[model samples]
Target: MSYVLAKSQNDDIHNAGECGGAVTSIFKYLLDEGLVDGVLAIKPGDDIYDGVPTFITDSDDLIGAAGSYHCAPTMVGNIIQKYLYDKKVAVTVKPCDMRSIDELIKRYKIKKENIYTIGLNCGGTVSPITGRKMIELYYDVDPDDVESEEIDKGQFIIELKDGTEKGVKIHDLEMEGYGRRNNCQRCDVKIPRNANIACGNWGSQDGWTFIEINDEKGQELIDGAKNAGILETKSPADPAVEGRLKVEGIMKKMASKVQSVKYPLVSEMDEWNRCIGCYACRDICPICWCCENCELNKDYFTLEENSSPDPLAFQGVRLSHMSFSCVDCGQCDDVCPMDIPVSLIFDKLQKKYYERTGYVAGVSDDVKPPLYSPEKTEL
Candidate 1:
């Protein structure tokens, strides 16, 4: 509903946080005021590439989750459904993340009033393994020596501890099949406005984050943070606003082109023949909540360990049931031990469903929703 160029007043937060720390400061404010019991966010686990989803119940621990993790491909909705339901929580959401959360809200699994969603503007995410290999192969730098990574100006840039940086064109990396995850490469949703507010470095200058407030809750977060003296705010210049829209527009065009390329169907592919029926994909899907009593577990469909799954009966049943709702998060693709591109399968299904019936995964409209597109200019 509004836009602001915001930064943190605290020097510590400004120095440590990504995009001037506005997001971290807001989380700190929420905790200090006891508005929420905890924060659900991502943090470095084994290293920068290993991002672990964590729940922070104290204000002091919030800063550990401050910076962005482009290499971390995680979904928090399933974590909430399995562990933190009924808790008053604040969480960070990417486009896919918010889409799954939106679906969950529709299902009445999580209450809107109890959760404050901070949407992160996402270009896309790199799988940790793929990222390391890419850096080694393309950047010609040791992946371990890299201290940070960022995607900007169509390049994947990595910074070293010595303060030196190297960049390689994303197109080049992706052309080599080494850049973002397969689902991310074609994902069209770049901003998660379903959250209270979306914050990122997309359109802001060096020391601030560009924010698009989407609702009253987002307004309250900004106003409350500023009133508490932890954050500073100013209206974004017209160019900065336009630049953000332009970036989203370019990304959508690329995604639409990628979407149009037809891949052979699951029935036609030999890849699905390798499925071990491990249920990893099904177990990891954030949208498939009925797994405990899933029909696939029935004796008729069950297969002995190491037996290949029936292409039509196993994956097909699941796809037909939930393909209309797939957000292309790629959690299924990420967990498949057989290395089958499950998300691609679901992506094709989602598009075909839309063609037959004019509804997106979460939206029931005849056309792609404007909220998910970069068509707005006045905001």
Candidate 2:
């Protein structure tokens, strides 16, 4: 592993990117150098809050994807698995997205060699609708006037178009149900170490990005970008490194408190009674790719007259099949029409599985989960 403070040499990129243009420059280098066919990243749609994933094949178009949107919450793993499996692509990933890719790679659903992951350090993401309302209710400012948003030091900050900023305590917002998604609040994986490179502003001075190169591929990406004269780098100072670690520790501690409060035993969740057998949760699950021959579709598992399914048969089936690999990305929770906390049970089970087996899913390359292995030995 290696650490460095880097920034874009290009004036436009340096200004357009969130902290620095390190990630965008790397993608540009990959595209210009013909290392990848395309880049998968988010670009603003109708507004800055409306972030939509875009696939760019041209180096010039990479500028549109610069900067970050905390409201996007789009998942690129399924997109890659479904569409870009055969093509070489560079993509930015949040921790959950990286975890989904790792799980998919292990399942042979995605080709590892064809994809390069540039992981972002994520605090969390707020849903678009909720975020807009949050601005109106809490910040007392028009959400449309906001040009940029950030989560830093326990505050949700927004920069308005008139050169003014507003800040709100994240804890206060969450107390009123206005902060990040429930799964995101409980997420402790702030850094995607499994990616080729992890980049963020945590350990850097202003106008720079702090990067951790996890492998040879990441080192090559950095070196190539610098060689192309689009990026510059320097070693980070000791205090900056310590500050980053301290911030990470605080975030994880917050996550642990949230987990205890949000994730109760599956037995206690009464929202399952509202399920309509729509199968939306399964459809949105990143790991649930069995389309034609899902066990839940079988006669034994499906009651012909009943629209509400047995929780054990439906959610339980999913937990057994993929819970060990669940990254708790919250797609299940997002798509559930009944508003069930679908990820809660799966996340709890995965954590329990980790406790029993000493396995943390999607974080390691050398070990596979015991359920996926042929050996019957207990941990």
Best by lDDT: 2
What's the TM-score of every candidate structure?
0.91, 0.96
Q: Which parts of model 2 are misplaced by more than 4 Å?
A: 265-269, 305-311
lDDT, candidate 2, 268-336, per-residue tens:
246666666788888887788776688787667765665445765676567687667888899988998
lDDT of 1: 0.83
Please report the TM-score between candidate 1 and the true structure. Answer: 0.91
Evaluate all candidate structures by whole-model CA lDDT and list the values in order: 0.83, 0.87
User: What is the Cα-based lDDT of residue 70 in candidate 2?
Assistant: 92
User: Where does candidate 2 clash, by residue pair?
Assistant: none
